[model samples]
Target: MSGEERGKRAARNEDLFRQVNERLHDLAVISGSSEPHGKFVCECEQTSCSLLVELSAGEYGAVRANDTRFLVFPEPWHTSPEVEAVVERHDRYWVVEKRGTAGAEAEDLAERGSNLL
Candidate 1:
């Protein structure tokens, strides 16, 4: 293909990647048992309800979000009284928020992982 065509193809690929990312963010991680990490299953406040998605270290173990984009503010940030108040009220969230790079790594690990655990 011509150089112009190649550049256009790369641009198209970037655009496609962005679109796919947008769609991925739209999804909620399903909650269940934490086998490899731990035996206990996460029981967010919504357990009594129909929601099954757990509070995982999404985005490692800093700010948490559940099945519906419902967010959990993990530590460091959790040090703040505001975050602490939420935790005190909810009393279910275990893990605290991780740093940005770690969060991205956790996401990658989850993507590479399986449910066999």
Candidate 2:
């Protein structure tokens, strides 16, 4: 695939991860309480990875505050160069934000009605 295609794919993968987290958050809300911390699958571009990162409700909220920001395993960006930067790093996970066209696509995904988390 071309570089553009790879970028698009990376952005879409991030959106998919965001959707999963949104659903998890909704479930937590309905259950009346969130655990002190919960495990969420790493939302990186690595298809072979099944790693789960632990995050507190507040931590997840911070990541959700930005449409382009995604929670990923540290160094996933090394393999997925489409990611533009590492905006934040926590003990368990890293926050990556897309750039250029990929960033725009992620923002668009956030605006969708289904993305209301």
Candidate 1 residue 106 Cα shift, in angstroms, is 0.5
* lDDT, candidates in the order shown: 0.30, 0.76
Clashes of 1: 12
Superposed model 2: Cα runs more than 4 Å off: 76-79, 113-117
**What's the C-alpha lDDT at position 93 in model 2?**
90
Task: Enumerate clash totals for all models, in the order shown.
Answer: 12, 0
State residue 81's C-alpha deviation in candidate 2, in Å: 3.4
Q: After superposition, how far is residue 117 of candidate 2 from its true place, in Å?
A: 14
Deviation (Å) of 110 in candidate 2? 1.8
Judge candidate 1 at residue 98 and give its lDDT.
Answer: 22
TM-score per candidate: 0.24, 0.84
Tens digits of lDDT, candidate 2, 4-86 = 77777877777787788777777776787747777777888777776778788889999989988888876654335544688
Candidate 2: TM-score? Answer: 0.84
Candidate whose TM-score is highest: 2
Candidate 2 backbone collisions, by pair: none
lDDT of 1 by residue, 19-109 (tens): 3333333342234434332112222222232222223334212332321112322323322221112322233333322223333333443
